[model samples]
Target: MSKISNFFKGGSSSSKSKHHRSRGTPSPQEAIHKLRETEEMLTKKQDYLEKRIEQELATAKKHGTKNKRAALAALKRKKRLEQQLTQIDGTLSTIEFQREALENSHTNTEVMKNMGYAAKAMKQVHENMDIDKIEDMMQDITEQQDVAQEISEAISRPFGETYDEDELMAELEELEQEALDEGMMSMGGLPSVPSGNLPSLRPGQRATTRRKVEEDDDMRMLASWGT
Candidate 1:
């Protein structure tokens, strides 16, 4: 009975472990983060290996003529470090490729999700609309706009005298002719002033004398017209 109970307990534990594993699976972003971390670790390892390789090379050079065995040992160690560095390089490359691919896939998934939402929104917007109904509504709107414009124009129309263009032009010409005739008649009715009637004076008094003669001439002209 104890053996059977142990077997059942083991089975239940296995099932729980599987459930936990399923739940604990990392998302793509988390996986990418892990890959980046791994890449960074490998890069640091590569750098360390390269520095060691350089150190080995320097040691080999230093011991070249002095001790053949030491020089040979240094070269061997350098070779091993180089091989490890090469492996790290390959691993880093693979991790980087995987990270980039995952990032691209995640971006594509988000884009597709957003596009789906946009399509759904457009579908909803067009759900209650048809091409024929839309055209009819647009036509009704245009007609209403035209009606409104005509009503506005009617309301703003001049309520005062309305004259034909030709008649207004003829009347304007008659009024202009009357003004011109009045001006000419008034100018012609003024008596002519004798140029010799201006008093001879010095240069300094010339301006004052000219002004006085103009005033007198104007008075005489007006009196003669009145007579």
Candidate 2:
């Protein structure tokens, strides 16, 4: 019974160790490095095998029509080498495919990680923002701007000049009447000429005589009117 218990304990410990090891798998970069090493080894082997195949082919040709048995042996060796080269080619192709797949997977993982970070940043940016609050803020800003514009227009308006329409019209009519009276007085002060005496007067004296005669006639007419 003691021995059985000890065995079971050992088995459990071993299983736990194995689980830990399984969890600690090689990273993708390490795996790709190992795959590339393998690819290089296979490529070298393929080159060697191809060289061997060529050597055998040359040997076979050299022995042809001379020694049938020797030529047949060389051809058989070439065929075997070619087979090995084909297997190496297949192995290299598999290794390259695995390496490329690992690289693509690594790139995709990084891309997904960056996208997750971006999503987190965007979430943080929107965390404190409420749609209703934003709308209210915008409305307040618009109202303030409208008030400022009204104030600015008020400040810019013309100031201090005012007049009554009736007063201005009356003053304009008074000035026009004064101008007309002055014009009529100026016309009345000008001299007049006598009708029949104007032809007998000398040209130089006509203007002077005309003025004197006009004054005399005005005075006579005034005296007769008084009588």
CA lDDT, every model vs. true structure: 0.93, 0.92
Q: How far is candidate 2 from the true structure (C-alpha RMSD, Å)?
A: 8.3
Model 1 Cα lDDT, one tens digit per residue, 73-169: 9999999999998888888888888899999999999999999999999999999889999999999999999999999999999899887999989
TM-score of each: 0.61, 0.61
**Which consecutive 10 residues in model 2 have the weakest lDDT in total?**
191-200
lDDT of 2 by residue, 1-227 (tens): 99999999999999999998988988888888999899888988988998899899999999997999999999999999988988888888888888999999999999999999999999999998999999999999999999999999999988998799999999999999999889879899665455665356677798998899999999999999999
Stretches of candidate 2 above 4 Å error? 1-23, 162-227
User: Between which residue pairs do clashes occur in model 2?
Assistant: none
Q: Could you list the CA RMSD of all candidates, in the order they appear? A: 11.6, 8.3
On a 0 to 100 scale, what is the lDDT of residue 221 in model 1? 100
Q: Looking at model 1, which ten-residue stretch has the lowest summed lDDT?
A: 191-200
